[model samples]
Target: MDAVFVIKLSALGDLVQADGALRDIREHHRHAIITVMTTPPYLRYMQRCPWVDLVFVDPRASRFNLVALSVLRRRLHKQHIDLVYDLQQVGRTRFYKRWLFPNGSWVGDVPGCSCYLKRPKGAAAADHFAHHLRQAGVSVCHTLVGNVGWMADDVTSLMRQAELQPGFVLLIPGASAEHQEKRWPHFAELARHLLDRGYRVVTVPGPADLAVCRAIPGDMLVPDDGYYDLFVLAGLAAQARFVVGNDTGPTHIAAHLRKPGLALFGGHVSALSTGLQHTCFSWLEADDLHKLPFAKVWQQVEQLMGKDF
Candidate 1:
């Protein structure tokens, strides 16, 4: 059996976006042993994915740390990988290509590699993944239409535990802590509007988002342990009638789940570049989120909800 390694590191949104490419890779190399190298945070989440055979954690130690680098090298040597796909085409991956897998058959942005995936200028992330996979002899049907259905657990019990019905609107009012500007300031107001319209509103907060998410007027969904992990969040997103969130991981998951949703974007990033916008999952971009009035978003929500609400 052929040994294949795919390297994709941090950021939950990026991981969620790569689901299509990952599934395509699995189909293309059906007989190969595919292993995905990701960070510790996503180890368990990726393990739940049916596309890959194995999931490995990369500590992401500095290049200067010879001991850690040597350990990583030793681990790679043990696998005898026949091919490598560096999905995370960053400086660290480039270094790994140059030093660790110097003579290996590699695919990505590295110079003189077996297959170099040169991203087209102004291409969206999903489009780029499709283009690269096509170059690697893999058909790219699912690259843009990624699904997270496999990642969803049985959330029925949890829904009853939270006293949520089947048709609640999911409000993800938080973004990455570092990018506070991406978060629209009117989610609380939006929640009020949704509630007043006789819609059941619920919010799922990650570990860091509790304080901000709780401030929004809605049913806060949490596990028995008082924490909502990625898997549980995926389950909730799959069941949500409509999702409204900032450009964050849960929003990406909800978008990939093919839920009718809206992803709010600010000056930090465009919805086009992120590829979070789908047929059902629309996006509204504002140059400055703070200045974005609640009325405009509500109008979009009304349109998004249609006669269902």
Candidate 2:
């Protein structure tokens, strides 16, 4: 194919998981112009991906916007794409085949496609994703590609301004607000413990995390208006001695970069699918984030770091 398009428009964690598929696509068509369609929030990070050559941001104006779909159709038609990889095998993407971009070699569950992935019964999400690529004739391998470097200079600038050194511990204390169960309660305490142990703990706080940020000890570093985008976070994380985070996007970024850390997953998330496949990473969890005490998580962090903190 001269031109290939991939669609995975939302959910930051899932987008990170699609790294392997993107890598497979790159390997499958080395010279093809690979474009990805994603939501506005993820476009910047997706643009950072080395496999994709271009990015299309879906405004997602509203639910079922026919006008927007028409504009999108016209826009995609301009690309003369030879293949469309629907990584998001949902009803919305199915609509793209049934309605908008109706004529194309789309590799998805939809009919009239070059290939289809009949998801194996009881397959894990990661397995299902990989299976989809393999069924679509793309070579699936264990390569990850999440590198936009959107703020390399900014990360360095901000770190230098803060007088922060490398090897500090990064703590991500927030999760999707809709899933309150995913937010762990002991991060502040963990920060305290790490601070007492002489490890600098830093966290970039969202508005939802202000309370958690304030609850931590004064020693913990919280960036003021740093605008820590994914690449910047990845850059800082790359230098960190350890990263501890809730099962959220940054945790996935850390996992993608294979950072040694503890991903605190609650019972709500499937560890097998979302857990970092790299051995350097580990996870600790309980029935819920509220129930998962600090000690259990600390033990896992120690194990990940290969020493007592």
Candidate 3:
């Protein structure tokens, strides 16, 4: 393939899954130029990833905006895209594909899964997208590249500024608006456990996660304007010995980056949402968590910490 286009718009976790697919594509077709079409909020993340050759920000105007659509159509034609991967697969994105690349080979969803409020099964979105690619003749497994090399420098600088110590744990306790149910109150309790165990704790929150960040103990270090960049946030996560979080985008990033961690699921989303990768990690159901005492969580943490991971 000379060039390919991947369309995955918003929502952090799904976007990260798209990145994994992009990595596999690059690995398989080293000479192909890969372009990713995503929303502005995720443009920065896609730009920093080495697997992608270009990052096209989805137009700010509505998909129905004819003028903006015309401009995009012209741009795609100029780029000479040979194949299109529609990871988003919404009706609007499908419309854009029809308009922009009438003859390009299309791969991905017809319209991806709705949010958990619709209560879809917990399958990893990356695997789901990969299945589509396979049906279109792209042979690859769903593997996570995580965030590496993308923000190595920024993470090092931030760690120096924060004076981070070894054996620190990262606590992420936020999710997007649609995934709020997946987040639990146990992050604070987990932080306390790590602290009492003589480990420093670093908490990172997105722009809207201030309330969750504030709930962390005062002793724990929360990034002060440092995590504005997604790559840097991933790097910070990499520096930690392990990460503990609800099923959110950063948790997936940590998993991809090879950071040993535990992902707490509320049963609102399924294990399918996160590819069932076997490693030094644990997945706990929200109801199961409610039943288990605090000691069980600590035990799981210790068990994970003891492994090679």
Q: How big is the positional error of residue 144 in model 1, measured in Å on the Cα after superposition?
A: 1.5
lDDT to native, each model: 0.87, 0.74, 0.68
Model 2 ranges off by over 4 Å? 61-64, 120-125, 143-154, 218-226
Question: How much does candidate 2 score in TM-score?
Answer: 0.88
Give the per-residue lDDT digits (tens) of candidate 3, residues 1-309: 588777878877776656667777777677888888888888777787788889888765677688887887787788788777676766677677556655556664433311111113455566565565565556665343433435444566656777885557888788886766766766678777767777888886777677888888623344554445566677777678888877787787777666788888775666555663633456666554445456667778888887542
On lDDT, the candidate that comes out on top is 1
**lDDT winner, 1 or 2:** 1
Candidate 2 residue-wise lDDT, 1-309, digit = tens: 499889898798888777777778888999999999898888777777778899988776554677887787789889998998888787788877777666778888786667777555444546776767777676767433333233233467767877888888988888877988888888878887878888888886666776777787633344565445566677777778888888898787776766678788788856766636533567776787898877888877766676555
Off by over 4 Å in 3: 110-122, 139-149, 177-179, 218-228, 276-280, 287-296, 307-309
| Candidate 1 global lDDT | 0.87
**TM-score winner between candidates 1 and 2:** 1
Ranking by lDDT: 1, 2, 3
For candidate 1, the per-residue lDDT at 166 reads 81
Q: TM-scores of all models?
A: 0.96, 0.88, 0.82
Clashing pairs in 1: none
